[model samples]
Target: MADILTLETPRLRLRTWCDEDLAVLAAISADPEVMRHFPAPLDRDEAAAMLRRIRDHFAAHGFGLWALERKDEGQLIGFTGLGWTGFDAHFTPAVEIGWRLARDQWGQGFAREAALAALAAGFERLGFAEIASFTALSNRRSQRVMQAIGMHRDPADDFDHPKLAEGHPLRRHLLYRLRLDEWRERCP
Candidate 1:
């Protein structure tokens, strides 16, 4: 088997996805509460397709969103890691940090913990100069995580997500950013 990149936090494991993770990931993706910030809950087929895309991204980029597993329970909670922004925007062609955890897994600091690990890898291992994250204006939860991880938001950087339709409630997004120097100062 090819070696998989895995990041360890105090209570979670961020690792590559496997066939066995599909069901759990599908469940998480289907949860309305878990996917509230997204366009909609994903069906099983969509979840499978997303998993394929994640695997493909890893193949192409050497890194992508890692399947988040709780260390204590050995369960797939969701995912957290880095990915390239796909849509055209001022921030196009940037590396972005993102995360999604099972609703039950919230409020435990897992998102922040995994994000820090991902950011560390992005800077120290992947050598990214900076990383960005964005979410719908209504997604305060994710915004909080962004802030907690040392990412700063500039209002002028906020823009409507091109993929989302105009007038869609979620089209308006807030952008957060962190450069290598900032992360080093915040973490070191």
Candidate 2:
């Protein structure tokens, strides 16, 4: 499939993966500070495999986590987009809005900006009734981004990630959702 470059925000452009992005993405994935909320930092090979998976997702669904670029500098920073959450939880078979950025870009509102663009694409262009996002309970930074983009969290819906072992610290996650109605109200 030809690369699809679909969404753009004021400061960022969300586009498809490219060969040039591999090195930077690998670096970002391998950074401990960037991967602190996840299982572990990805090695180069693991990052390459993840890039392949991301490409496949876009081919299969026409939209996955799009590679993020700083429009001003034309540099890859990270990714923010919609994806199918694939795992079973209190909420299974759901579409999710997610983002990950380079450490230096964290304080600049890039994640929230890219996420709002993704949410608009999912709700306005794609006609999705709802989209959900979840993160390790301790990832307050991500939680803040989700809330900034209008997703609501109810503690009652939090779940232990099925893929993690019982005692794993990252197993406990909080779920957040935004319905089309709510999104429309917020955006309109």
Cα lDDT, all candidates: 0.92, 0.90
Q: Name the best candidate (by lDDT).
A: 1
Give the CA lDDT, 0 to 100, for residue 93 in model 1: 91
Tens-digit per-residue lDDT, 23-96, candidate 1? 99899999999989899999999999999999999998888999999899898999999999989999879999
Task: Record all residue pairs in model 1 with backbone atoms less than 3 Å apart, i.e. clashing.
Answer: none
Model 1 C-alpha lDDT versus the unseen true structure: 0.92
Q: What is the C-alpha RMSD of each candidate to the true structure, in Å?
A: 2.0, 1.8
Cα shift from native, residue 20, model 1 (Å): 0.8
Model 1 RMSD to the real structure? Answer: 2.0
Error of 1 at 113 (Å): 0.5
Which 10-residue window of candidate 1 scores lowest in summed lDDT? Answer: 1-10
